[model samples]
Target: MNAEAARTPLFDEHVALGAQMTEFAGYLMPMQYIGIKQEHLAVREGCGIFDLCHMAQLRVFGTSAFDFLQYLMTNDLSRLSVPGMAQYTLICDDDAGIIDDVIVYRTGEIEYLLVANAINRRVVFDWANMIRDRWSTHQPCGESAPRQGIDLEIVDETDRTGLIALQGPLAIPLVEQMMPEGADIPTRFKILATTIGPTPVLLSRTGYTGEDGVEIFTHASNTAAIWRYLLSFPEISPCGLGSRDTLRLEMGYHLYGSDMDRGVDPISARLGWICPADKPDFVGSDAIRRIREQEDHRVLVFFTADDAIPRPGMSLSANGVEIGHVASGTYSPSLCVGIASGYVPTGYSRPGQKLDLQVRRKQVSVVVVDPPFVQGTSL
Candidate 1:
């Protein structure tokens, strides 16, 4: 493996457990530990830990930090005023197409941490810099921390932060077992600054699995010890990218590049809630405004089927006319059905909307339905 290819601290552990490794986002991460099916089952039945340290962690500070984020992002961070709160925001290009999506965690009054997907690190950072530069010369970052640049001078990306995602039904219990006394796994969507054994870890009740889980961010120096400690939990198992992808797709959630991209806006992605009428002009406000007024087409409707499974870029047709195409899909272990989400005409967004997936030489019968094909033990 190339040293600069980037790796999570659990590289050795994943190899020891016999993971199938693959190159994703320039990282030699595990594609699957046992197998995608088995690992997917484990997350549904028990719990799983994923090494997510390769994802980018960006810090924006200085006096204009809040204002900078507002100008670039769609969601209003002002509503996320309380400490230990995390809100999902979409970064849009000038055309209102999604440049990327990130979660902004307000860690302090003037300091904010942005969690961006690994593939679009440079794109997001450059956008952040443009916002800072356009707003004013008053940089919001702390003077002491040199803006260790990736694609921008104002964005200070810590050289290292080890993040572990403890997911599945038993995630809360497993994480609590490894945490200190005051580390309360209190409710979903809340972030707590706590410790795992002796290491300071930021534990957040958020996950992509459509399960009740916690994502713990800690310093890289302590990752080895924490990995060993967390593995000791009877309910917590180790999972890799293969299972993670299937799990997220099973819930009808969007993946960054594959499901959403620069060509699509939130309305077409079934993410209309991200845009509010009263919110100030974000990057893509004008483009989205026209899309909304036109109501030209509907976003992808999620669905499940025992037969006729769909994959990304596959054709979705109605009668003899091609109406839409699959954006994301997977074989759901829990639902025992093939599930998918894709774009269709505005008239077909409702349930029981009949459509056909032109898979191979055959047209498979499919009907639109709701998501979370399987129920989570918690909400």
Candidate 2:
């Protein structure tokens, strides 16, 4: 690991467990503990815990926070009219290109917690401040400026905070053991403020894997203690980023850099569902609308390889002619097959469509399929 890479609070705990550490988003993180396959299956059949302290956390609040975010994000903030609700939204540029895909949690009447990908921490934070400044000074031609009072503030809280995820079939049951009596576990896409044993945390029922789980946000200092306490459960496995990638790939979840990026629009990435057509004008609404109406655009699709494991940047060919490239790919532990996602022209993006993946010197046949490659899990 690079000495310049930062370490999370649970870094020592991962080292104690004999994990293989690697550099990710300028952080030295665990790539695997026992093994990727074993850890992947553990989350599918039982429970697994992941250290997500590297993810970026931003706090936005004040009198005009609601209106500020309404213009900044692509999703309708009205869905989270009350506290304790969470919505997955995309932060895009004026060209409709995705800056980052984030989850916004309404923690109070005028407060929000935005969680973004670690690699995009700087970009997303800078973008937020730029928009906030623009809204505060630039007044529209005829309409009243939403930032008249300039009461909004955006703060990066990633270093001072810690994030952990407990996921699987037994995730909820295991988490309930630490909660106070009569305290209800939050449902999917909901957040609750409570204490786990002695540590106060903001628990949200959301996860990257297609499993029933909760993400706990607590003070950075309490991360190690909480991680160790959860490990006391005999069935809980300490998972690493290797298994995390595979689990999400099986669920067809979009990864920030690989699946989508600054050059890709949500509509082309199959994430248009998050952008409501009835919402008020936002930064990228016009460009996204144009992309939606255009007929000549590439579409993201999921596919399965016969025997070879595809990887990012591998070529996708039809009739021996190169077309697109794989965005994300890995072997699925639950399904025991190679699964991948890539972008291809809309004409050849349908399920059952055949494409050849160039794996090194060999060409492997692949079939496009709908997502959730390995179903029947505890979602």
Clashing pairs in 2: none
Write out the backbone clash pairs for model 1.
61-140, 61-141, 62-140, 62-141, 63-140, 96-284, 300-342
TM-score of each: 0.91, 0.98
Per-residue CA lDDT of model 1 for 1-379, tens digit only, reads 5667877777888889888888788888999987888889898888888988878889877666777677778888888777778888898887778888888887777777888898888888877777656545433342233233323225646347888888887887767767776657746666778888778888888888888888888888888788888888777788999889888887777889877899888888877687786785666777878787875666768876558678888888887899888888778877777888888887887888878887888778888887656665454
Residues 1-379, model 2: lDDT tens digits:
5799999999999999999999999999999999999999999999999999999999999988888888899999899979999999999999999999999999999899999999999999999999887767545453556445677879999999999999999999988998998898999999999999889999999999899999999999999999999999999999999999999999999999999999999999999999897775787989999899999899999999978998999999999889899999999888888999999999889999999999999898999999989888898
**What C-alpha lDDT values do all the predictions have?**
0.78, 0.93
In model 2, what is the error at residue 12, expressed in angstroms? 0.5
For candidate 2, the per-residue lDDT at 110 reads 88
Give the poorly placed runs of model 1, Cα more than 4 Å off: 1-4, 137-158
In terms of TM-score, the best-performing candidate is 2
